[model samples]
Target: MNNDEIKAALTSKSRSAKLERRGKIISFLCIALIVIAVFAIFAFVAVRGIATFVGTKVTLWNFLSKTAWAPGTTDASGVPKLGALPMITGSFGVTLLSALLATPFAIGAAVYMTEISPKWGEKILQPVIDLLVGIPSVVYGFIGLSVVVPFIRNTFGGTGFGILAGTFVLFVMILPTVTSMTISALKAVPRRYREASLALGATRWQTIYKVVLRSATPGILTGIVFGMARAFGEALAVQMVIGNAALMPKNLISPASTLTSVLTSGIGNTVMGSLENNALWTLALLLLLMSLAFNLLVRWIGNKGAMK
Candidate 1:
């Protein structure tokens, strides 16, 4: 070959190799960016929620076991503690009550929409549910302030800041989450299961209850768990109606607060980097661990059920 042709061929091959190397580098950078982004997000969550100090001594277990959550106590005789039994109890109390109230209604509504309703009816009703979900949490808080608080206050003896008030509002908020999940789960159930049950002379209700519901139980449970998690994480509306009292609730009518509520209240209570600050940070870590453990438990149960 001529010198000119050989030189051109060599240059062309070099250009192709350089382009290939550039492509690999770009691909590697993209993957690295994604990995870093995910790690940073999770690391931030873990730091605030898991790494914060809840106890300086061997007091975390004691604090959780104690009923009173009085931090920064007034008297010199009485040592201040971060016992969070009240807030923990209040949060779970409201969450369980709200989920119980919301789940059945949401499931029934979802079933009706998916099974009984005509196309036009579904189109009408679904939007209303979606609209409810779309409403801001702050607006829900305002509604509790205007309507729910007064009703609870008048109907019961105490101020409208109690577990019942929070649970009531939370019930309304959680309905959308449960309903949407139920609809998706029920719709995902295999039609063959329902048909086989029907062919065996079962009524429509019987087939749905025995076969379709059972088959879709996994998804349904997932939805319920997710709804409960959302309710537990809720702060704005619950705090709005929950009276923000740091005491343990004696009755559903008594004003109460939760861990999130206490955290919010503590923001301006002390100097930054003080003991009180460290204690609250510790509490923050505890709360994060509690939530993470609950989510893991849900997944573990799901896996067990799937294995069966």
Candidate 2:
């Protein structure tokens, strides 16, 4: 090649390499910032949470197992009542109930979309599900407060703010999430699997039950876990409907409170360094841990499915 041409080619290569390196550096910096922010938050919450136990010398057993939760007041023994059992039970109650109520409907909708009527499901239901997912949490809370709460109060013979109301609201909110994930799972099944099942003299329903759903079981479970996590972490909606009373849930219609609801309600009322504040931070740490556990469960399910 001529001198001019060779020099031009070399210059172009050098510029391209510089741009690539710049892009890599930018991407790496962005990732690093995200990692640092996550760790910072975890560390801050942990320090504040542990301070409650460290400063007050509250036994972990009493904090987790006792029922009284008057963080601002001390009993006759001169110890703060920081029990979190009521909130823990309430959180689990709503999460499990809502997930159970939503799962069947989600699976049915997903089956219809992926197997029964793909054309109609794609054209109509997909947009509807997308719309549901996009609606804000506040709107859902308002609707629950206005509609579901009143209906329960009138029909169920109680004040209406309770676990049952929270369950209904959460059921609706998580339905779209579980449905979308199930659809993706069902669609991921190889077309050959369906064909082979059919060729083996299986009916469509049998094929779906024995093959498609069986294969998608792990994905469906992951979706349900995600839904449960969403329900567990929900604050404002549950707060509006759950009566805000930190008591053990007596029944579905009894007034109660979850960890998120209690945190949202009381966090602003306490001083920054008070026992009340530290107790709230501990609740926040518990929420973080539960979310982490849900993610780990999802990963385990995925790995098991892969191995199978």
Candidate 3:
């Protein structure tokens, strides 16, 4: 080809390449913008809720670890305590209860579904468990109210709505999530490993107990963490079964409110500036921090596993 013809073709190709790069850059920016927008909405809502409760200014020590938790007062020394310690304890208690209830069954279900189930178990039982995931939390609460509370009240007597009832409801609520995540995580482990273990004379149960479960530990823990987060946030269903009292529960059968239920029921009351209200926001910020920490930890752990 003549030099002029070659130059003309090269210019045309360069222009097309430039346009393609620009298109990709634009697409990437659009996706990033969408992600940022979503995070922004959550951030904005959380901040607004805090401001409505915490007021404009904040102190260093009080902001960090004050446990008093009463809201409202014009004075800086008015003692707008967050009562974060007890609330955190309660949240952890409930989460622990749910997590303990969930782990064994979820792991078993996942193991059976992937490692032990027959063809019919895989096809039929898997679908049923999957279906259970679609059930609403409120329905679970209703069931808890009708059968669980009555059982508790009848067996245990008065103060029927208590931590145990709420815990039971939470246990049921968190199960589907735990089981589904566990199943998916276990399934994600390499099939080749299982086969190799069998070739090496490892029994099916041993191969799973030793290799598959070990590899999927991080993923399974992630599911448990998610369950904890969900249980921490659960209010309506818990409130229905947990008595509305603010006092610390003496017994599993005694009535008491969770941190979530307290925040919900407290805000609308006339005690807007009460220590309780301010404490609620403080507890909220702590919860937000907790959730963020869990997500970050999950990411870090997942990345660490991937690196290995």
Candidate 4:
């Protein structure tokens, strides 16, 4: 109403507007930086990956189909045998086996933590499980090399370093990830769902199986997919136990190699601009693509579950 009051109100309004504009600019700059970084990484990998084929006579079919992967050797006719099917199969075989072994146990533990032993889990078990995630991968590799390898060799026979060893180690590494995610997902389900099931005379077990788990399917699947992704890309522990043999896996107990193992092992052996080096780049590109595909699959599963 007075001139002094009018001036005070005008000053307050001006300060608020300036603060809002500054916040918006900061947020936009953060988002733009993230976009630039992601695109830069993709461009770098793409150029290096495609450069492998430049001036080389290898076909995509030969690279993917032939099982022999002798990057440093030539045939009797002096042609390099760059077939990658063995490594591809080894990667998928170990990853899938580890996932199969881990999923049911992870889900069951998640259910018990969230539904059955909420009090103890909240106070003790959950923190202990979360702590497992921070332990270095090399520590797990050491334990497997010392303890599991000898056990497998004594029990089953053969050099203990094989697919079975790799699977068991990866299974342990992925458990914490799957269990934490599943617990969070199960906990996200509305409490009313359980109450309504109980009102209908359903037992606690039936309510969990039919109502809680059904509603939390998306989260559970997302956790499993994430664990699989980690297993797929794992290099150190698997490489330590998998024997590093660049051949098709004959059986679960046979020595084998995965894509990551080959890359780490072969990178130092090849010259910078040689075909072998380029082929390794191609394998790196394939790994990146596989990770992207897993992410897309997770999004699709989540959207489908949300719709239901």
Question: How does candidate 2 fare on TM-score?
Answer: 0.95
Candidate 2 CA-lDDT value = 0.94
Candidate 3 TM-score, true structure as reference: 0.79
lDDT tens readout by residue for model 2, 196-245: 99999999999999999999999999999999999999999889999989
lDDT of 1: 0.79
CA RMSD for every model? 4.1, 2.3, 4.0, 2.8
For model 2 the local lDDT of residue 170 reads 98
User: 149-216 in candidate 3: lDDT tens per residue?
Assistant: 99999998985788888888898888888888888888889989899999999998899999999999
Is 3 or 4 the stronger prediction by TM-score? 4
Q: Which lDDT tens digits does candidate 4 get at residues 211-298?
A: 9999998998899899999999999888999999988888877899999999998889988878888889888888988999999999
TM-score each candidate: 0.83, 0.95, 0.79, 0.92
Model 1, span 56-83: residue lDDT tens: 4425575676665555552344545666
Query: Cα lDDT of all candidates, in order?
Result: 0.79, 0.94, 0.75, 0.88
Candidate 1, superposed: residue stretches over 4 Å from native: 1-58, 74-78, 118-121
Q: Give the winner by lDDT: 2 or 3.
A: 2
Local lDDT at 235 for model 3: 78
Number of colliding residue pairs in model 3: 10
